[model samples]
Target: MRPQDSPTRETKRLDGRWHFLADPAGAGRAERWFATPLQARDGVEEMPVPASYNDLTTRPDLRDHIGEVWYQREVRIPRGWAGERILLRLESATHRATVWVGETELGSHEGGYLPFDVDLTDHARAGELVRVSVAVDNRLTWQSIPPGVVEDTDAGPRQRYWHDFFNYAGLHRSVWLHSLPQTRIEDITVLPDLDGDTGLVDYAVEHSGQGSVSVQVLDASGAVVASDDGAAGVIRIAGVHPWEVGEGYQYTLRVTLSSDGEVADVYDQRFGVRTVAIEGAQILLNGEPVYLTGFGMHEDHVARGKGYDDASWKLDFELLDWIGANSLRTSHYPYAEDVMDYADAHGILVIDEAPAVGLNMAIGGGIFGGQGYTTFSPDTANEATRANHAQVLTELYQRDKNRPSVIVWSIANEPESDTDASYDYFAPLFAHMRSLDSRRPVGYVNVMLSPYGKDKLAGLCDLYMLNRYYGWYVDSGDLDNAMLHLRDELGQWAQDGKPILMTEYGADTLAGLHSLDGATWSEEYQQDLLEATHAVFDEVEEFVGEHIWNFADFQTTKGIMRVDGNKKGVFTRDRRPKAAAHRVRERWTRIRGRA
Candidate 1:
């Protein structure tokens, strides 16, 4: 859970080819597939772990399969891990997963984007072959977090959801086999604050066995700047360098657990000395007003389909730097931990969001569909959905609480916040988020349908995050009316006296498509829409940020509204720059220079 490694810890990546089988009839569990080798079963194929099975296969049946799938692989325990506590860790396992070692069930987990580990110390011996089987289910119901429904069609089962993106699911992250000491550190929390010229780091350590904990704060040069001896205490450093926007200054906090005068475990955590506060109509980072300029991104690419690719990940940050942007929101779900590390090292701000999208049933047809039904009914997104949402928020906070780049915790994206039922649903969730971590601002992305007068949950939020599609979804190719409507909405929201961030605003632009005049779906149109939106953003004094709708084109559910996929990206899906990318770069560069 804590970045996976330290001096007393070791990890091995179980991320190669594995035997896979799709159980569209839901017969895996009844057939006892986990008890024997998957090769003995029919229709089994070799598939790559840490990648979605949907896009990897050539068969359409496997691509759109709607039920449980099984993955089996053999792992050998290292001889050096004889006396250590060995564990099997999955970085992510789609919507839900159940694990099995040999014939015994290890455990089960529900959330898709977070990590979970199963202890294998008592099951396997050193230097022995162990068979690991995992069954992953991609179905989503009213009780699920990002709720959806599966309908049986004439051909097969069809998966339907309210969100605009494709539901590509599998083991979309790495699988790890790690070893830890018998008496080791379980969790470490580092909360850094600033007082004048001094840096105060409040720390806490949770260990498994009895031990004496000591902490040392090391600077960038690996020199000890402060030291403390306790399970929980504060360490002060004089003349501290604050971690600023576009300038990442990190200090390492090394924690050591000693028992019987011998070293039990050593873990080092990286932290930045900074604080986030909301004052009047400004969101301040370390007491300075910081504007967010980036995109609402997804962990999606060609072939991988929500799977984590290191090359694509690195190129994304490189492109963000090229565009002179400062921040981004993990739009719908929590991203991989390594991505957070990259943002932390590069000084890019993050709006950490939960996987609470598509809570409204009125727009199940799409964002531009009808809106009559209530969003929070017993058969739809009801109390069960709220419980799952709360669990994800807790997991998200526990994972990324110490990171300095996380400035805001977005609860949901574009829910039906105008309805009275929505108010009852989201109000407690916002309060729950605050109870988890009050240091950062907590709010949800408001849909265009939920205007200032109709919205009820706005009063509960610390700040406002609006996803307005003025020229695209609302006004439709009329820039003049779109800008007018955008300004009017901002004027109404500005009256609330809270910092407002435009979390989404852009047009779908096909690459190389041009017109003499700005036409819809043309590259010129995308550029003009962004520039016009920026003009409006500058007019609103409460506007603190503007992250475009998407960073790149990504696949979505098949429909008449999509051409291949969403083309709102400033760049193509393969990472090619469009005309809008250059325009954004020019504007953000000036903004960064001014700051």
Candidate 2:
């Protein structure tokens, strides 16, 4: 559902301090913790909402705790919100969560990194004290989307997964208590296209009750350029301004629903007039070939793990502008809605992805590993996992379908795409995505192990996204051989006649380490690696983009390979620029100027 507030809607943000408790033994539910106010209970501590509870304190037990955690807060509904439909909206609840309002269960959601709403109109009264409690589980299993397994160790229960990122869990986004009209507009779908010098906008609205729908296309100056009177129709505008790369031109589609000749609800959807298409070996935006130059980003920070911070996000965009980059991939999962909105307003392109990582068992030594088992076996990533993956794809499409910056939909990142069983598993998912929305192209990130010769799913993709660690994982510290191997691989992929984008290629370098001989893990080596990769990218005719492995340093599970966290970022964890950042700025600025 559309959660954006409008003229007829009111929302109150429930972000701040809340009483927190860790249920390591999983006794919260059996003890009936949600039956009363949590403040009345003993051994309760205060923690900040909209942030991960992992690194918020000094206790190691709390930092590395598994199982369930509880958050409770008291909110007083506004007296003016009487006669309105009140709803409790959780922007995100990591992994899984269940909600309660004074012993009465509201609802439960299974996925993380997406918004879900629980009806509160009949459960609580307006202008009254309402207690809200949430129980979130950080456990993952074979049935989970990004599948994982829990091992019973001598110390305690251990969570293991194949993904490189850390498992930062809790409420990592904002929560809201919003009010809407009883018979209000539920959803809006806007499709904008360019025709010669005219703009055509096709729209469809879904409402709860019967009403007459009226739509108006307004330009940037708030002038009505086109109008239509129906729930689903097309509005055409003459002398329209097409939304081009690096030019944030948008038109507002104002939708109003009327019942008995009176206005019931109004929603203003901001959209741009543009279209995405792929020619022979070129990715087109508005019928013009466009080059993508950016990095694969993560929703991570210094203390706030995967939490949304406005200041840090703004700084990231400023740095992107300084580097002269145009696009980025929401690596491994879909990012926050605020990030998508900023990309829309600032003219930065995005490749929206699903949380379908770590589907391979060979890397993580999963339960079926060393047993001659495939990744798509009945005991592993089988039908249940695929079903969950499809559900996330549906939710992702529903949430970001209207954003103009989202040009491509990436199904998964570095899945096991080489085996025939893997192909059988993902083929239907790719088709399912197309059935959901046929306007955008869909693809998956190919790992180095699944090269052009062995990958079976490459024939099914609209474009090829390759993540090769040539100089880092493959030919370590050998730039000459690395470039040769990279060129050979690109030549093999060019035979498919599809546009290729290097989604991830980088070396981990310490922030302060420098070497005159270009040794691995040194700042100079990172810069040299990038330069060498860029040289290969320019020589390939089918290459359309070059996105670095990571934008900044981020936290990960502790291992001998990582010092504190992954040091593959061009910038430090605190947004400090490294030597590679300067090299990238110079190279990308020249490329942008040439384009």
Each candidate's number of clashing pairs is: 0, 0
What are the clashing pairs of model 1? none
Shift in Å, residue 500, candidate 1: 0.6
Q: Please give, for residues 105-195, the per-residue lDDT of candidate 1 as tens digits.
A: 9999988999989988889998999999999999888778787888778976688788888888899899999999999988889889999
lDDT of each: 0.90, 0.89
Q: Give candidate 2's TM-score.
A: 0.97
Error of 1 at 577 (Å): 0.9
The total of clashing pairs for model 2 equals: 0
Alpha-carbon deviation at 195 in model 2, angstroms: 0.5
- Model 2, 1-595: lDDT tens digits are 6565787788899999999999988999999999977777777899888888899888988878888999999999988889999999988788889999888899998788788899899988889999999999888888787778787899878887777888888998889999988878988899988899998888999998988899999899999999999899888989999887777788999989998898888889899889999999999999999889999988889888888888989999999989888999998788888888899887889999998888876555212233233578898888988998999999999999999999999999888988889999999999999998898889999988888889999988999999998998889999999999999999999998999999999999999999989999999999999999999999999999999988999888877777788889999889899999998999898888843
